[model samples]
Target: MCPTSPSASIFGINTVHRMSLQSALIGFLISRMLPTPLTPQQIIVVQTTAVATGTMPLAAGFVGILPALGLLSEERDGTPPIHLTWLSAVGWSCSVAFFGVFLSPPLRKQVIIEEQLAFPSGTATAQLISVLHKLPPPDTSIRSRRGYLHLDTEDDSAEPTGRSPSSPQPIDTETDADINEREFVQHEGWHALTYSFLASSIMTLIAYFFPILFSIPLFGNYLAKEWLWTFTPSLSYVGQGIIMGFPTAVSMNLGMLVGWAVLSPLSKSQGWAPGAVGDMTNGARGWILWTSLAIMCADSVVSLFPVVYEYFSDLYRAQILRRGDSSSKEDHEVETEDRLVPYTWVTAGLLISIFVGTILVWVVFGNEGIKPWATVLGFILGGMLSVLGVRALGETDLNPVSGLGKISQLFFAWIQPGNVVANIIAGGVAEAGAQQAGDLMQDLKTGHLCKASPRAQFLGQMIGSSVSILVTATAYSLYTRAYPIPGPSFPAPTAYVWLSLARLLRDGQLPEKSGVFMFAFAIVFGLVSASKTYAARRQSPIAKWIPSGVAFAIGFLNTPSFSLARLVGGIMDYVYRTRYARDGNDISLIVVASGFVLGEGVISVVSLVLRTFGVGVISCWGCGHGLCGGCPAV
Candidate 1:
């Protein structure tokens, strides 16, 4: 649900926080607007719908890249038809819905049940929902006596039967004292979240005018100016770092050190990339992106292979040996089956989505569209790759949809060589599939914890997806019409990266000097990631020291300034743990982080709207001078 708010929006608002923020906003609105408060089941439905709806719009971002780059036919107004854009969004929604319904179901048991991979975002959102609806309204007693209201009915069945390590364990019973304690905790949590949110929002607004406040040159002016090694005051990155954990942050900084300090300079000095240092087309940034992408790909492949092998092995046993469906199932299995999405529903949805999605692709893309067979192949590959995405999200709480999309691009390039439109569509389908599948799995995880019916959640997903078709389409069209994407106002950095990869695949323009480095680094990172996964599973101590490949690749992908800010966040987390943590739990830290992310994100959307209206911030402070980037004075 981390919809790209604006170019000015603060970074680091993660998926969990975004979803929670949206859910909170919607839930609050419903409570205030409705004549009566919703039941717990109704609340669950609302939250799930928000999540599903938010998850679907990512496809708009992916497809928006094409039109932004002038790949699509433009009307006389120099914009794609709004109707056509809406249709494209519908096509994307169909593709995403297919994977969410089809691919995710088959693997839920492996990822969420047997392995118990921590979909941390899901767990957090579920916790937030619980807190929000845990108690009745304060005025309920007064209103009930007047015969105007009834007490909120508690749904005892919603209690989780089992707890995953990532989620808080529910108490068996609540005494008066327990209830009081819970209320106190909730009060404190909400207080911290509210204050932190306001603080971050104020800081973001201030930084917009005094840009130097956003970027401090901590590593001396030479490094800051030359290599972009500056620290930032933005709480968003710090919050993100806190959420990702200290070790991962450290790993990311190490990657930044290697990429910016070592490889970038080395490549530039050797004339491998003679363009401007930061230029995405022919600069050090572009040069290193390949190696970074390779590392991510290698890590993804290495981490996924064992899981894929096991999945197929289990499938073989289940289908061939009849071992999957034991007559005497465990209690959990029995409970799960009662609420699980029925196979008949999945089969029907899958077939219909496949047909509709294929035709939509052909129609939307016009003459250079992907063939139906190729589109279906893309869906198959997307389904296969979604396992990789889902596993990543489950384990690390990061979904590398861009990396997944690039992999699809490479494959389509080989099969349907040199067709840029075909390549983008294929990659976009794959990206949407992976994204939607991962999102659905996470929602399912949340539902599992909440003990909400799977059927209800799935239905919520469909409704939300329908909503997404309209919302994403409108937003994409309006944004494209308003601003020049890939330009200063929007940048659309991820879209640029996607376009770059697509063109590279189309033209076969490998940076020769970086080829050996990419290959070698990919292998090394792959081994490191695979080894870490193996060691972690075996409870080996060495896993603690191993750098996360995904984080490392992210370091390479992002600027040094962002990495430094994250390092600051990691330090803050360590300090908090050492000084103030209770029972080794980071409940307060989570609250504060979520607040920071949500605050900046919400304000940034406001900023975007203001900027669009030509209502700009004034440079009233001396810090507005162009020492740091993005200064209004510049």
Candidate 2:
């Protein structure tokens, strides 16, 4: 049987109580299991539990189960056991211990430099602190050469009458202390925990439940046709615009339209129907699989180049400039500042590693047996498309799997119409999963600030996500069993290999409109790329124009209602940010938002549980509606 779901209670009371219980349990278990006292580093290892257990475990479980069930692999009707073994538990425990020990020294050094030294903010550690607690603004004044020179005289005498006239008065310690205390009270401790929990819960709930709501009538049907109309003159839309910074959201929505609605439908109409070109015996599907993998690999390689360049530049600058200086002790002293890894480098490395690992797994495990040349070409195309994908959607701060999935969908649509629908669904699931993981990160950040064990947070996420799996799997199974997609409808990739061959046959013509379209598309793409670069360098007006243009294009292309929903979300986000900014960070709004998110997530879990028991209820409509028929009538 699956693990028992946590007892439902009100946010503050239930959560705090449950956490306290869990913490005690962990402490007790550690004392009984371990032979020695855990070092500070080992203590920190607990944090990994937060990641390991949540979405990661859920994802792993899904991957494991899917292949066994024939939904994902050749194996059929096999069920993996769900028992938690002794060896597995020990491995997890050791991993947590090692992570804490390895991370502590750096973390400790950061705390001292950042907290005690009173250094200026904006460093990685500082940002973490700020997110964890309220921090005073950075000191913006430049240290003048003359001021440094005169510092000795000021220190030598209580009253230095000969000090430079331009020297600014020293800060009043008492007043500064009072201000710092107030800031700390406002940002750190319980307040930070509250905000983190709220933000994470809300984001998670929305990611999980929005798709379900999107399927309901009036709202779902309307948004699927007229996306923009839903958001016209709406405050929520305006708010969303402000919070997401307009450009990113607009671009992402436009991408969805171009990929899903337009390309998908067009592919089907071009004689790319299933079973028309090749039989399963010809190994046609293997070619498409290899093609997709190649694209993913190329994209990963392109993404890594920037990171390598940045690292080398930093190494050169450090070794050649400051330490290499001859003949000046003073200059050497001034140059010997702490080394740091730039945020850009970290971001790039993370993206490249994730995509590369994913592609490797797919290529090695996938059933496809395409040619080496085709794989290489696919990789190059995937990499080229990566740039376009980023511009189209903005940065997700989530997993790159969904982005790659989208690229696959677009490419497959060009090759075979029958694969379009399956690709879209896959993209959606991958994206949604990443979004859920991101929500967990927000929570983990909060937990980090609050001195909560990272391991605990990881465990919490695993527990939470595992709950989702049980619910989602059962619901999906029942729903599909009750109302499977009919014949002639899309077969969801597994049902047909002929779809790919049909696409190849239809597009086999050499001197066709497709080629013409490709040339024109290339030109348009070059113009956009050039424009974006200029905007980045010069902060040109086009920076605003392009995203807006994309948004307008999407408004025309997609259902007005879906666009309307996005606009509504944007507007609400804008207002929330504005209000929070004005109130000087009350933390209450964050809590309220978190409540909404948690409520939504909890409801989803409930729905899933009910479905597993064979109880059916009408799902709620979109964000605008709170409750309909999903909840049992009192």
Q: For all candidates, what are the clash counts?
A: 0, 51
lDDT, model 1, position 490:
42
lDDT string for model 1 (117-223, tens) is 66767665555455455632111111111111112223332224232223333544334443543454455766777888899888887776555676666666666
Which segments of candidate 2 are over 4 A away from where they belong? 1-214, 217-245, 259-308, 315-564, 575-592, 618-634
For each candidate, the alpha-carbon lDDT, in order, equals 0.64, 0.32
lDDT, candidate 2, 255-320, per-residue tens: 445534453334334533232111222222222222222322333333333333434564586577
Model 1 gets an lDDT of: 0.64
Q: What is the C-alpha RMSD of each candidate to the true structure, in Å?
A: 8.9, 13.9
lDDT, residue 512, model 2:
22
Model 2 worst lDDT window (10 residues): 1-10
